[model samples]
Target: MNHALQLPRLEKTIPLSVVPSRLAAANAAVARFLIQAGAVREGDIPQAWDDALQVCERALDAWVKRELGALHCFRPYFSLAAVDEAGGYPSASCKEPVRYHKVDICWGECREQQWAVGDALEALERQQAGCGAAVLDVLREKSRFVYPLFTPDLACDVVSYVYWCGEENEEVALDMECGDNEDEREAMREEMVTRKKLDESFPAWVIATPRKRRLSRRALARLAQDASDPLARDIAADVLALATLRIEDEFRPDVDGEYIGFGAVLSWREDDLTVRIYDDLLQMAHQSEFCDRMGELEIAIDAPQAMRGWQSAMRVRFKTIRLLDRLIDRLSAGN
Candidate 1:
């Protein structure tokens, strides 16, 4: 991977402070970069502001060409990022620069040939035209020109391009919205294809859990409709009930974008009395969101342990599974 770009002469002129938050740090860095580039003025007259924007646009155009190569090789697309209603970067008003720093870059026919955020460089390298390599090289060489300052690894990646395709244009609105469950995903896919005439897309890195394995509302509906045996349906419903609490394996950060949190799966056999819990459901239990639901379940009585050994964790998981099964049985029979 290439190292981050630095314009040494500009850096020498201005000292940038490291901010506590990633976004703030990036904003400060970009503002400093733009000021140095003469694309933005600290305090200036109205006519100078327009002139500065013209300079900024020229910079974006040149950088895009140098980094991405021929304009025809890429497609213009917009990404939606969830913002906190509370506070942070002030939301863009109609008249101001969109200041959208977080976005996805995709090439080809808008849908088919796009790279996921982190994977973009690798995909570009694969093109063999050296566009990807060139882009990374230029980016590293003149890093400040890009928005939402990020490492070569794409960590803390920010959108630096100020221009956007407006919402009125159907052709440019490439949505990356992923619904929580497979049904929702399918529904979104259908909407994209039939209604929007676009292919359903997702982040390249996310490994989607299989539809059958996920215990979602759609899974519950499938079990209720397809399972011939009453007990099987009840057990599946109970599992879905537990999993739908949407327990997260990671802690909630103060600021986040669109996310579909993790869910759980139960692996059981027809003859076996115990079921194996997959994924970090115990971690879910520890989260306050699930505390009340977990407190009511007898399985919560067992002390939650950080899974050190699979053998030991499996033993504990079996007990918890059995407890859940018994609870389901009683509830089903009206006990």
Candidate 2:
């Protein structure tokens, strides 16, 4: 990855006492952007702001764990505005030099991570390229654009935005939206074809779609059973069994809700299958197998907040179906 495109590492530390105020400012800016874009009603700002704050808090917690520090501040370098284009609803666009810094107090220094609007646009393009232009183009038309100020890892990071495209919608709706019934069907057909191709190419690959309900054991079993390849099937079954046992033994029932995070991947060669579960898609690129297969899988969750639960459960529901593509290539060559 280009150094400019990669997320910045922490370099300095900010005072903990200033975090709450900084977060408030960041929330206010996001709320303003959403309202101006006509994405949110004035009456909804209060509740939306509260929800945004919660998401920031959750993300901050994750950052703390990874960086061993707390959030320092959010420095806004650019602002989001609604731009009216010919023959369309006002679209949100970022002004030039559009960027923001997410500062965290790590190792006694106030380190800052920057995500520019350009970076977001580039990331979106990469996502569309990976997942299929048709699928994302349809989603983009109907969905509100949300630019994450920080590096997003889990579903919560994506869902933290205050505004959604539709009125009173809680999450980023993945349901294919089209003008007519025929168009909808055509879109679905195209998506199904794309999915089928992905499956045939990478038997272990899985795509995580938005879900409305909790995941059940039966659903997981079905997923395991759905794998046509012996190795893929075995890996799926093993992941299911291990995830179930871990949840049962290490934690109580997930009263919060279902597991609806981003995605997971299981990579194996020959007799040995390795299970690696992750919510961050960008980090997957660091893996040797995924390095060359750019745009093969969606890199970010573009919808609403996903339900919180066992991270492993997400693996069962939306398994990584493409990680083995390169591995298979190498095996064929006896490399």
Candidate 3:
């Protein structure tokens, strides 16, 4: 007999029996918020809300399958549920129905619950009535479930490249200046040759330099063309493409002249891990400190800023590359 089967079974804190009602309540809250905010007309609230809910649910399902594939036993039971006063403590104001909840591992004995949804009613009631930040935050969080900034495979490739570059040439400094004049260019050719020597040894030396510099799309394109190794060239090309899409699609500046980005927190409890993704750029900047402890690679993108013409001030922190690689490896192994 398998000893694992003999062990006490872990039951879900929030059972699946209450999931439908919770989801309905949460969706209703979201619908009401949208209608009140004029995002959707009161007449079109039902269809619009249902469509949005379906989109979020589908994205959540895909994210769970991709990220938690190794935990096969928990995959089927994990679901998006709303937190009520009974199942879990509701938000501060109990006068209204709860508008906050997140994806729960419904089959396990996990106690920790993440805040995946925002309190729409509270935002309207307490804060500025027109402030739709909470609604946008919820949508952004769900969207990130489907579209992570860096996928596990891409992150691993980047880490490998950075490691290879660092290992190949420890003596070569990456502080060379580019010259605009022809004479200056000729003078720097020897330095360029030295840099090329470093690149020749390890072609994947595009990012993670000691000095901070914004990576312009033009620079990335140039690097892609100059890369000697096919793999390095492809990686540089991929980065350039991703950077372009990210700036164009996601990293738009808000009315406050600040760019918005998603932040994620990974917590491990025994063999199970939970990932909480939120739309808090300030928190992301605060979390950059983790890069020092947990090996990190920062990529600066020259994105557009409100009022400002253009700024290469966007920084993305990939601190969980190793952990993500382990998860990916376990998933690949059919665990």
Candidate 4:
């Protein structure tokens, strides 16, 4: 996969110091990056959000391109750091002709495409130097625009991303606000389509657990419903309570624009109990925002470690599959 891009001569030039928290570090770093970029006055910050944002918008122009690159999603992210050296950073700019240097700073994932990357790296750098307020700034913007309830800042591994959402300190709600019944249905259908594509790519497996290999006719109907798409999530949950196996998976299917949609493949595992868990999906867990394909499987949490191991294996397999597919496709196309 192509790596994320960078502009020449961009460097961070700030002295290291202790700060109260991540927020303070971010505030300070934004001040420094802005001052070097010749974007704002140092005194403008440590104030209300609006005044501080003016300084941010100016500097954001110089680095905004890095935020939109789609590659950051499929490939692992590396550091896009500011340069530092023994005893001192390259140069300090108390004035114009702002100093430049090179360094590496790793950033977290952002939906695998069109990352809202501006906040995390900024927060990280500033926190190391003693400020992370800009993290909050970017977060406020996200809460206003995207998933409102979930902070979307907390970084997690593939498994964690599916099980949980939100950042430090309590739950944040994602505002997938439903306007009316029609909108909700459409959203559900969209998610279902995404899940279907995911199953095609990763392909959910049905494991035979250590249970009686028999299920009710209702059980069969439920799996068929979840396996396809839920007509009602509530019913899905109720049916899930009867499941024995577990299903673990996620699909990064998304739309880039009005006419542009793309999908990121998924992989997951459930030990010795695929049929029981698959039965859960047949019911309705797919309807809720937090639960999908395997929501019912989780209710059988008398078995998390086995599920986790299976999920991990699945992730490895999916990643390998994606890489191999890309390589084969490239070789065939001779690109």
- What is candidate 4's lDDT per residue for 1-335, written digit by digit as tens? 99989767623343233333433443445455445533344444434343222345433333323333322224332222233223223323222232223222222222322223223223333322211222222222322211111111221111122322322211121223343466665665454322233233221111111211333435444543653333222222322332222323332223222211112221122121222223233243334433211111111113334433433444433333233223222212211
RMSD of each: 25.9, 21.2, 20.6, 23.3
- By TM-score rank, best first, the candidates go 3, 2, 1, 4
Model 2, 207: alpha-carbon shift in Å? 11
What does the lDDT read for residue 332 in candidate 2? 23
How well does candidate 3 match the true structure in TM-score terms? 0.24
Model 2, 1-335: lDDT tens digits are 65666785643442222324444455444444333333343333333233343344344334223322222222112111211222222212423221222211111112222211222222322432222222122222211111111211122223323122332232232243543466665655454323233233221211233312223446446645774545434433443443343112222112232222211121222211111112223343344333211111111111112112222233322121112222122212222
User: Whole-model lDDT for model 1 versus the true structure?
Assistant: 0.29
- Pairs that collide in candidate 3 are none
Off by over 4 Å in 3: 1-59, 63-219, 242-335
Q: Give lDDT: candidate 1, residue 36.
A: 46
TM-score of 4: 0.17
Point to the candidate with the largest TM-score. Answer: 3
Q: TM-score of the candidate numbered 1?
A: 0.17
Please name the candidate that would achieve the greatest lDDT relative to the true structure.
3
The sequence of per-residue lDDT tens digits that candidate 3 reaches over residues 23-71 is: 4566555434333333333333223233344434444445434434443
lDDT score of residue 261 within candidate 1: 23
Superposed by TM-score, candidate 3 places the C-alpha of residue 269 at a distance from the truth, in angstroms, of: 27
Assess each prediction's global lDDT (C-alpha) against the native: 0.29, 0.28, 0.31, 0.29
